[model samples]
Target: MTILFHDTISDSHFPSTSHPEHPSRVQTAWKHLDGLGLTNACKKGIASPASLEQIARVHTDGTIKRAQETCARGGGYLDADTPVEPRSLSAALWGAGTGIAAVDQVLTGNDRNAFCLIRPPGHHATRSQSMGFCLFNNIAVAAQHAIDHHELRRVLIVDWDVHHGNGTQDIFYGDDRVLFFSMHRHPFYPGSGLSSETGTGDGLGYTVNLPIDVQRTGDEILSQFKQRLDRSAQAFEPELVLISAGFDAHHRDPIGGLRIDEEHFRHFLDFVLDVGDEYAGGKVVSMLEGGYNVGVLAECVADHVQGLLQRSLKTGSLKD
Candidate 1:
């Protein structure tokens, strides 16, 4: 259950410190992890910028060119909510590249799993459009890399970002090679996670969504999460597990209304790790997606890393 992260992930930044998706998100977490010595405890890898070919797998050439050209012109908003800067393109590249590296590392047995601590929270970026403060879909890129580069036949993506992982869902909607699951707040930002929105064609039923339309206690949320996750993981029998780990679901978050907290996330991790142990050989790659409260996000990151470490010591891997 060795956890791997790239140090260069901290280089990602936005213009406004007040922005929810600012560099301090990672910087604060890195400092907290460092204070606990988990920064050194976890394996550190270099985060190289992603190649255009890799980006092409999940993004359109137009999308790539748009990001490139916009940043070249001193940066602008890709959408009303998403902003960019001179270095945002570089950040987006490294962020996606970190996901690729994490997939490669975990799949090749170099590490048991990895936590991509990069920013510009990605699950919101569609193939042709970047929105909701997301530049490129990092988790989607990682899952695709696993399917194409690693030759994995079945991959499972679990996104618990409070907001629907609409872009990731769209990219893999018709592909059976990847199974996408999202437990999100319905009628929320970008608003596209409905229980009825299952995958189409070859990917029918592969897209599982739990649209939380009402507020539920953390305990109740965990109960629903456990049942659904257990059944899906058992049936799918995925070769690898990728997580869109967003702490914005925490009750402390200003933008979200969910009552989930740190313990619930740990419980979420425990369940996912159990699924990984049985179906994916403990091969899980997690990427940062969305979390507004930097303090709570940092704490959740620490607990997640500790959970991986402790689980490894207790059960030889990340299982409940």
Candidate 2:
């Protein structure tokens, strides 16, 4: 497995201490990877920013211009939750580009799977607006890149963030080629993921939402994820697997109320890898989303990365 990352991601910051989405989130996870020796254990590469055309696949020209112009003007708030820094536009482009590089690595057989540690975490940014501390939908841009560039027919995106990926769902709502599955806390922020809110038109059954209660445990979440994924894999047979991996659902996270622990995150990765092995030839690319508790975030990220490494080794995908 190869890990895709960018040092510049740490430069994306808002001038507020109260913000839950901090630069320290990615910094801590990187330090944890070094402490665990995972950094030396896998192949690593620096990520480049996505081009305008690449970003335009999932974001409108106005949205892209707005983010850039905001950054150029010394930064401001896009909304009450989303903030911009002079470096934010650059950071967001790299965030989206890192996901694309991960996809290329796996599809080209340079690596079997990859994990992108990026920030100003996406998944909440819609086609026309940035919200919820997100500036661009990184995973969505990568998914579209696979369809347009790689000519992939089926793609599976599984978002395990505590909050539903309203932006991702919105972007692919009418596209049948992508299957988006999200398991999140219902009646939560940006509340939109309802079981009844499946896809429309050609994408009617492609979008699946499993909105869980706030009090649900990792065990329960894993069981539900596995059950649904198993059924969906049989029909969709995804050519590529993507995970909107978020650790904010951890019991200690201040922003979310789920009871997920490090062990459950490992189990979640295991199930995702199993799906990849069975259907997608063990190809998976995951990107960081929301995991705010700085102390526990690193631990959860390590566990998730370790799971990916172990599965890649077992499947003989790890490079020598």
Candidate 3:
């Protein structure tokens, strides 16, 4: 029941007052975790800025340097949606660092599972471009960290955001060691994750994309997710699990059309916990990615983490 947070994420506020991906998103989630008694397990700290080498594991040097330079110029938009202010670079670096720190915590036996609360939601950022409020792909970086730093041969990334994690898929598409799975709304923003776009090269069939219709109920989403994840994990037998945890699929979220409620997240967590227990020894590391509605985001994450922590307690692990 260990959580790592990049406390200064709030500093990466976008320029426009009307941006949906604002700093308040993480603040609300933090407050709700505090109310749910998981915040104390949450270690408040700053992630050392992800070094160029670390970032280069997933991003090209040109893109990484350009992003740094853009943030250095004091403010701009990588796209119409992803805005950068004076504090954006440090915040993006911290977001990446949070993922790295979570991996370290899990690898060092400090925790069996760790949730990182930080964002400029990644998933849309590709190897060369930032999109959908993400500059660096946090989960991608963490997945690489597990492979490099911890020597984990197989890792699985499960993304349940309303939007596709095109960047994550793109980064590890050909690597057999990384299994990328996503369940996202089809025909949405950055719409690239179709069912046909499975893996390629040595990683063919490793990437699983379940592009559900936007009209699904919470139970339906959870059930489909559980089934696919179980089938995939049993087949791949990953040593670790990484989640691109996004709350935007909640019914109250404006961006997503799915009907996932708090109970849905609870069920999702329960299912993931069982899978972790069975395959990964209950090792699941989650990172905050997207969720715009403050109330819904907070409540959903509170429920999700409570499930994770409860499972950790059952497993007798104090760290994660």
Candidate 4:
């Protein structure tokens, strides 16, 4: 497994103290990855900014222009929660590019699976707008890249963010090529992802939403995730797997109330890797979405990367 990141991800900052999504989050995760020796165990690469043409596959030209223009004009609030700085546009481009790069690395056999430690966390940005501190839909862009560039027919996207990935769901709601699955806290921020909100038209059964309760423990969430993936894998038979890996659901996070911890994240990774092995040639691309508490974010991310490394070694998929 290889880890893709860039210093600009942590260099992009919001001006307010109240914002929980800050650059320190990535810095903390990197610190723990180094402390735990995961960094040394895996390949490391710097991320490059995604081109406008690549981003245009999943986002509207107007939205792309708006984001860049907003940052150019001294930066302002795109929404109540999503603020932009001078460096935000560059950060978002790199963030989205990282996801594309991870996909390229895995599918090209450069790595078995890759984790993108990036920010200006996506999955919340819609085709026409940016919200919830997300500027562009990074996972969506990567999934599209896999299909267009790799000629993949089926892609599976699993979002475990505490909040629903409404933007991702909306982007692929009518496309059967991508199976979008999300498990999130109900009655929470962005207030979407109802179980009944399946896909429309050809994508009817492809969109799966498991709206978990706020008090549910990590075990409960894991069980639900496993069951859903097992059932979906039978029908979808994903050619590739993409994970919107968010650790904000951890018990210690102030923004979310779920009881997941570091150990649970490892277990989750193991399960996902097993699923990938079964259906997707063990190809997985995971992107960092949300994990606010800097204190524990690194631990969770390290556990995830360690799981990827262990799985690669076990399967003899590690690249030289």
TM-score winner: 2
Residue 227, model 1: Cα distance from true site in angstroms? 0.9
TM-score of 2: 0.97
Model 4 lDDT per residue over 1-320, tens place: 55545555556666566788888888888888888888888888656788999999988998898888889999888888988888888888888988888888888865778888888889999888899999999999999999999999899999988999999998899999999999899989899999999999998988999999987878988899889877987899999999999998889988975988888778778888888999988898899999888988888888888888888877875444
Q: For candidate 3, lDDT tens digit of each residue in 27-77?
A: 877777777667786554446767778989999887787777777898887
Residue 186 of model 1 has an lDDT of 76
TM-score ranking from best candidate downward: 2, 4, 1, 3
* Alpha-carbon local distance difference test for all models: 0.84, 0.87, 0.81, 0.86
**Worst lDDT 10-window in candidate 2:** 2-11
Choose 3 or 4, whichever is better by TM-score: 4
lDDT of 1 by residue, 229-301 (tens): 8888888999999999998999888777598989999999989988887898888888888888889999998
TM-score of 1: 0.96
Off by over 4 Å in 1: 8-12, 315-320
**Residue range with the least summed lDDT across 10 consecutive positions in model 4:** 1-10
Model 2 C-alpha lDDT per residue in residues 50-154, reported as the tens digit of each score: 998999999999888988898899998887898887988888888899988888888987478888888888899899988999889999999999999999999
- Cα deviation of 74 in candidate 3 (Å)? 2.0
